[model samples]
Target: MHIQIQPIDYSIILIYVAFVIGIGFALKRYIKTSADFFLSGRSIPAWVAGLAFLSANLGALELVGMAASGAKYGLATCHFYWVGAIPAMVFLAVFMMPFYYGSKARSVPEYLKMRFDERTRCLNSISFAVMTVFASGISMNALAKLLHQLLGWNYDLSLWICSGVVLIYVLKGGLTSAIYTEVLQFFMIVLGFAPVVWLGLKDMGGWVTLKEVLRNVAQDPAKVGLAHDTALASNAMTSAWQPIFSGSSANLMGVDWFAIIFGLGFVLSFGYWCTNFLVIQRAMSAKDMGAARRTPLIAAVPKMLFPILVILPGMIAIGLSYIGKDNYRLPPVAISESAYPAAVETFQKFAAGRMNATATTAALQTIIKPKLSEAKIAALLAADSQQKLDSSAIRNGLQDAVADNDYDGVILSLVKKYCPSGLLGLALTALLASFMSGMAGNVTAFNTVWTYDLYQAYLAKNKNDAHYMWMGRVVTVVGILLSIACAYVASNYSNAMDIVQLVFGFVNAPLFATFLLGMFWARTTSHGAFFGLLGGTLSSALFHGLTLPAGSTAGIKGGWLATLTVFPSEMAQNFWLAACSFSACLTLTLTITLLTKRDKSDNELTGLVYSLTPKVKEHDLHWLARPAVLGTLLLLACLILNIIFW
Candidate 1:
């Protein structure tokens, strides 16, 4: 479970950390105004902005969460990138980036203010600022947990050290520092994880053997653990398309094509990629409109290929467990009888990840039934197959429970098992970079939005730019501190990825609809935009309140009202929540737009609204070099990859 950090390895990590701090200090001279601190002075080149755009997202969300999901959902986890990311990213590049960059608004919320009104801007800024901090906190939590679990470092101390390095760099260099650092992190991650996939696949006798090993794990009952479904276990694990083709019964993600397509692909994907300020801030910092439009497009090329670096490691970890080359095993997660009912969703998640829901449920049954008396088991089974097993004696009977694989630790554990001393340092550094990048991306975005969108907009207009720049630095510390507090909040969750998507559903899903209407539909009034946003957010909360996931209690995961419906899994719930939010927001925005008067004239909407603005024509050498052309090629490439995998 732990990697022994040699002195050389420690030296490598320390050197990287020192360089990170040095970059921040070096960039300190550039911070004259709030814009300089927050926006990188709009001077970054396209390629740098593009990589920074992509790297901003490569944090723990990619390195750990994707690996964890890959371990849990099998190949279907690729859907997050192939379905959920590529298309949205393309949309951002080709369609949305123009408005974002051309409007000259400091942040996404400022764009909303420019297009709509102050109330809308205020609402978005507040929510975005809050969400960024929480998102930042999740990254911090993942980093701290990684260090604590793998290196046996103190958890609290890890949080401080990780956050401290990021704080120093971001505090000095601001977005400029974070962006360049993210570029470095990007290469580190690739260099760090590329070998992981190579070493794993090579050890298992390459690609064919990797699949065979995974297939073996999927079909074996003893190895299947809580996974009970045997029929499509291999298919679900090995083939992404097969599970959906067989319907929800075989879908490893517990979501049908409709939910996968509309919920995750369209709603959640577009919501996060287009509107979330973290990634958008990178694009928004581009030197010109052409570079801005190209920022996400440039990032898309590598993004399409990142799964190999991230997801394969997790799959390799599981496959390695079945390989006789090493004594390493997937880390085990113990579920107490008291915690089992609450952890039903968690258990089914990874068990089903072995391939299909039936196996997960059956394996879950196998783990518990052995400890309970026949009568107690019967009673529990009679009441919804042990889901509502709340009796004291029944819980007492289930004292000796089984532990599941710690899916979240799959990638980090791989580093421990397979990597050599020096390579281990690079891998560790790469992981640390990803964690810091994700955290810094959020913190940078948070400070910007807090400074320009919230503080200057309403708090104090009389404050000079120097004062606002000072506030930006202050909020950097404030954001990281708050993120530390939120890390403890994140520590409660079983899946960091699921919680992130859930947060996006609440904050970003409805907001995308707002942007869509405001940009393209010039008729969308401030009243419509503001209330539509409110309606969408409320609907998401309302929907979540009414519906509970199958293996969960009635709490934050939903059913706070009454359990009107139950989703198959938490992932499914998150998808549907986003879908509902988007639909509600769009409908409400349209309905309210139809009823309300348009406050802004066509003149005022000129650069802000897409339809009202002139078509962007880049003064470039060739058509292929243009953002749209590049974007089209990227989409085609993405489609080809999807089909090849399918």
Candidate 2:
């Protein structure tokens, strides 16, 4: 925690802030109409959209979470980067983006309204708004927590600092401003983290030392890669240690395979890439359909490389710990309510000498000083053994400090202890930039929905362009305030990411089902879209409520409801949740379609459905088929990984 914040860090951050604000105001020239504000006048270049998409997705959550995963899961956590994301994105570029762009809709709900009816659009818009709010709030909370932890700033102050920066840019330039800022951030953050990771690897004695370290930790001198124990499996706790999904008994729900592949891979991927307003909005701003389609694909290649910068350093950190016990320092101290031993022999000596606040702090520093040194501070680690590794010192020292808690503190400790001063500041700045990108995207999406779908559609149906633009600005400010309040509320929640993703699933999953049916099935009715959405959402919520238990492995399995882990023994939690919700909603959609009087044809819709029914322009349907193919291939690859790990 003894980070020396240099003036250079402050300077860099200040310049970065000014540049962001400047971009926002500069984009004011582009804000000629509602279309321009929301979609960059639909004229953003593909290259810009590509960078923005990457930046939007690579926010603070991914940076911290990937690092945490590296500390916990070793090389296998990179699956999220490669197996999960790359193919999904390629799918988005080739298949989904065209559908969205060809539809020529301003927003996803607007597209839905064109595809279904007014009722469906309204329902989707509200759900999307709520989801965006929850997601943005938690992400903001994450950014604030990291800022406080890294900079010694107050959490509330950090929250405002973050909100202020994002607001200026997004409010000034709209989507155009957000996209350009995102591109700048993409470069700054990636550049900031890359060298730190490279240096950390060097400190660990390079790749040769890294192999030995991993071999030692695995207690297998021959095996060079990450450790795998098929017997260990992918339970909540076990997945933390082993990257492989099927090594343990915890893969009972096929979560090891199915959850990542079908559930996370297919459902979550498409939802974010094609449907989520925050991400798709970047594409929507493209000057034409081609730029929109190519932008995400361009982003995909960089995203594939991002995990290395984000995750590998933490793995190397853990590996470093096993190389030489004396040379390797203990991780951070974890506090718990457990009563401290009244007088440990070692502590008694310090206490007897009357170690007060300054003395106590100094003593702790002395103990940790060796850990900060540049040299390989190896000492006589074992008396009875030739191996210069002291297991007792390392284990006993860390065990007392981190007793009963998980190893989350370890990674943070390493960052504080080893990362250099300027780099530390840069990293913190990068994290802030990353955090703002997410918050900005969320706020932008929320504002767009409020302005177009709700305000234009209902509140001020006949408003002039100037009035609408002003309203958009006002709603954005109000949304920012609401987001801050939500962030404060979210700070009290446990496992904030898990909560965010799950609530997101509960709300957004039904919409996914509705949209998919609406797109593929012509029999899909307005009534179908309405009840399908309702049934899918309610059923998912019920399923989540009834079955999910404490300490679940799947990301979407934790909640306040999970605390009461009492359920019938017949069904796996996720299966019932997914199946019941998907089936119920699907059936409801079909039943409603059959029951309802014929409303209108796809010809009546303004977007992609128009192409289907010859209502809109007939350019090409080939692009729309690509995501389906790539999704299938990605799903297969996921299965193969599962089998290999199993």
lDDT of 2: 0.65
Give the alpha-carbon lDDT of every model. Answer: 0.80, 0.65
- Model 2: per-residue Cα lDDT over 1-646, one tens digit each: 3457788878878888989999898888878887777778888898899889888877777777777666555555655655567766776666556667887788989988877889988988887887778777877887676556545678899899889888888888887898899999988888877777787777887866675565455443112122233333223221222433443234222244554555555655555666778888888888877677777776876776675688777667667655543465334333221322321332334434544434433444354422111111111112113432243443344233331212333434455656677777676677778888878888888999989999899888988888888888898899898888888888775566456667667666555667677776666788888978787888777767656543444234533354445322112344335545666777889888899876766566534542464332225646443434444554465455445433
Over 1-646, each residue of candidate 1 has an lDDT whose tens digit, in order, gives 3578898888889989988888888988987877889999999999999999988888886678888877766778888889889999999999998889988988998998899899999988887887778777777877787678668899998888888899899988999999999998888889987887788778878878888877776666245342434445676677767677677657557778888889999988898899988999999999999889889989988999988988887777777766645776666553443555644544434433443444434555655533222333333344434354444433433332333566777887878877899889989899899889889999999989998888887888888788998999999999999999888878876566455646556877787889889989898999999999999989998998899988789876889999999987777888888899999999999999999887999999999988889989777548788877888898899889888878
**True lDDT of residue 532, candidate 1:** 95
TM-score of each: 0.88, 0.78
RMSD to true structure for each model, in Å: 7.9, 7.9
Quote the positional error of residue 520 for candidate 1 in Å. Answer: 0.5
In model 2, how large is the Cα lDDT of residue 424? 70
Each candidate's number of clashing pairs is 7, 10
Instruction: Looking at model 1, report the run of 10 residues with the lowest lDDT sum.
Output: 369-378
